[model samples]
Target: MTGVPASAAGGTGAKRVPAPKGKLGAAAVNQASLWNIANILTMVRLVLVPAFVVLLFQDGGYDPAWRAWAWAAFAVAMITDVFDGHLARTYNLVTDFGKIADPIADKAIMAAGLISLSVLGDLPWWVTSVILVREIGITLMRFWVIRLAVIPASRGGKAKTLAQGVAVGMYVLALTGPLATLRFWVMALAVVLTVLTGLDYVRDAVVIRRRAIVALRVAEAEAGAVEDSGASGDSASDEAGESAAAESTR
Candidate 1:
């Protein structure tokens, strides 16, 4: 009783309504603000994507100065990605705009950097295409089940994103000696992680859709049962009234 609500004090038979969770929480998030700090950071990240590409392809060659600056811009964008998400969650500022825009920014940045890498012939075109398909496909799946379920970024997904960034960053810097060889293996590992995480997301989406469907059916069934009970009670009252009238007439 120290901090409980008044309704819970005396067993007065009043039902206290609780806040909704699960998919209902997703609905609430979808309806929230797009004007928050988190969303602003995400928008900034989107804008930086093309800027990174431009700096990357400048002078038509791997000029050291241009490559260094390109890597710096990419690094800043990724840093914003980390901060925006942390600030949003810590401050309860999760919004649908952030949800959709954040992932788009993430994938777009990777696509921009990786595509630039392949175009410059530092990385293979086939690797770029595979990573692009996986990223785009998973992102699309996220939106497909967005309203029904807000899937928080998984740890494996985060690791995959980090691997992508590290691999791309190392390549962007045009590292020499052992580090260049290391970057190749890292890029390979990122590709494997990308495919694995994509499959995990597909499995998650299916489970979420099933759960939402089951919840909907349960809600409908409860409403129907309540209506039938009310109808039965009304019929009983009518019959009792008729019996009482017959007795009075006799």
Candidate 2:
């Protein structure tokens, strides 16, 4: 950075020659291809979201056959969500596109499932509303702090997601007998985890945001000190040059 040409920094309407490998710039260099297998699977999940919704509503929405097929489609979408993340991490195939689209796909699919259930009388309206607020709020929080901090998903959050999928899946099946009790318990746990994890995420975001602001201030102060040191050095050099010239003239 120190040796970089001043001309490069102060160029006036002049196009600078870019490095050969920097055709798309430095950030793009590290970005993975959008068409990777992980991303494709994510897109497939998005497609299946609407499929799941349509299947859930088919034939007046109460038909046993329709519910069976709907559950199967939803199950497939959930399965893909598990693999897409694994594949992305394992293959280092994560891209900017994936980072954005993947979450949107996830939230969209989950929202469709929860909303559909509420609409079909399988879930209480208040439960759906609570979960939806948490889901949407946390998602917004992520983007809000994206520039200053990163809040990775916690184990509780992941468990909550799994719980939701399982609970919703069971409800779609309209299961009978002893399994109904099991479903009720699972759904209860899912709701509890959902609320808890939502609170946890909010707390984490607040802490991270505060720390980030502190870090930024420290960085700025250090930069200012560096600039001051550089300015002092230049002033000393100029004074030395002037003193020598005056002595020679005397």
Candidate 3:
């Protein structure tokens, strides 16, 4: 009761509560729906991945025409990744499902494309292996680190994605004779960006781990202090009540 205001006491003198605005109204709107345009885009991206893989591996060879189609599909899927997040923020369409599904879809599409390209001998297996390992490792790290800190996409990560897109697109185009020479250059750029971005991610994970340890220690200290304070307060209150009762009896 020491911390409680007089108005909060059970009495007729209580003041009327003020009408809530802004965030309260926004929260009401947020609770109304979970589906939105961003989620639709994510679903579309997921649907496109299989079709793109089919195109990439059709006819037991990388047919130039199918490769072209695959490139288009991959490009569209990548664009949807960007658009989905943008639409989510712009339209306030964020949802837990969207957050979960979006990354899964992205990883699936990337894995399919990379594996197909590696199988087709369009890109070096070593390059794909390194990229795949980094992607999977970082994803797992993200899950672990999220308990303590947020891991938003860094600029280097975006650049790495762009580099991969260009590399894959060029590799697909290389199925046609005219673009074959450019494929190696694009892939080389991609490899460089991938290695740098992977290192950056590893560094970020280390920092996140350190921060998480610190956060856990701080949280434990705070919880212990709260428990100590609560116990002391209760003991003191009991003694005061006993003293008052003894005085009244006397």
Candidate 4:
């Protein structure tokens, strides 16, 4: 027929669905190129790490004005940190680059701030050491278990980040009296949350790794069973063929 058949375009039978126009765009976004907004924000934070250190140390490293400017840079980094993650999650723009670079950026800025304060005698060395160990250990653990599964950031982890940021920002500034004491308490809270969340992450990693191992064993068993069944069927077919040939010879 000159016209397309009814069953082909509009019929009660199976029909071809037209591809959605936005499907490719959605996939590209979800795949999240390195140039995506989230990753770009993460890069900005990383770049700010060095800039913050330079600004913080300007004017003999004790100038309140310079520290204030350093604080501004840090605040911008921290704010972008919040938005990048939100955008990635909300828009399905998550990517491997974001996963790795995001955490690294977070650790770099916080680590720089903490270490700088410690060097300046503004913060205790023990506080910086404890936090650095925990942060580095958790980051490594994430990579260790990444092949099996991802350990998502917990609520406690988020709280810890906020507390650390606020406490460190306060430390970055020149505070005294009640405000300085308040910052101490805030940092104490951050430390507590850091240790607790670190333990939680270890637990989660163990559980996820165990589950992954179990799942792998189960899959192997299933595949072996399937292979054995197919082999037995083939053997049965061979036996039947031999019996038929013998009967035909008789």
* Highest-TM-score candidate: 4
So what's the TM-score on candidate 4?
0.87
* Overall lDDT per candidate, in order of appearance: 0.87, 0.87, 0.82, 0.91
Question: 3 or 4: which has the higher TM-score?
Answer: 4
Which candidate model has the greater lDDT, 1 or 4? Answer: 4
The C-alpha TM-scores of every prediction are 0.79, 0.84, 0.78, 0.87
The residue ranges of model 3 lying beyond 4 angstroms of the native Cα positions read 1-35, 175-179, 233-250
Of 3 and 4, the candidate ahead on lDDT is 4
Residue 160 C-alpha lDDT in model 1: 94
The window of 10 residues in a row where model 3 has the poorest summed lDDT is 23-32
The lowest-lDDT stretch of 10 consecutive residues in candidate 1 is 22-31
Give candidate 4 misplaced runs (Cα > 4 Å): 1-32
The local distance difference test score of model 2 is 0.87
- Model 4, 107: alpha-carbon shift in Å? 0.9
The residue-by-residue lDDT of candidate 1 on 105-140, one tens digit each, is 988898889888998999999989988998878778
What lDDT tens digits, residue by residue, belong to model 3 across residues 27-93? Answer: 4465346656788899999999999988888777557787788889999999999999887776567
Arranged by lDDT, best first: 4, 2, 1, 3
Residue 163, model 2, lDDT: 95
RMSD of 2: 9.4
After superposition, the stretches of candidate 1 with alpha carbons farther than 4 Å from their true spots are 1-36
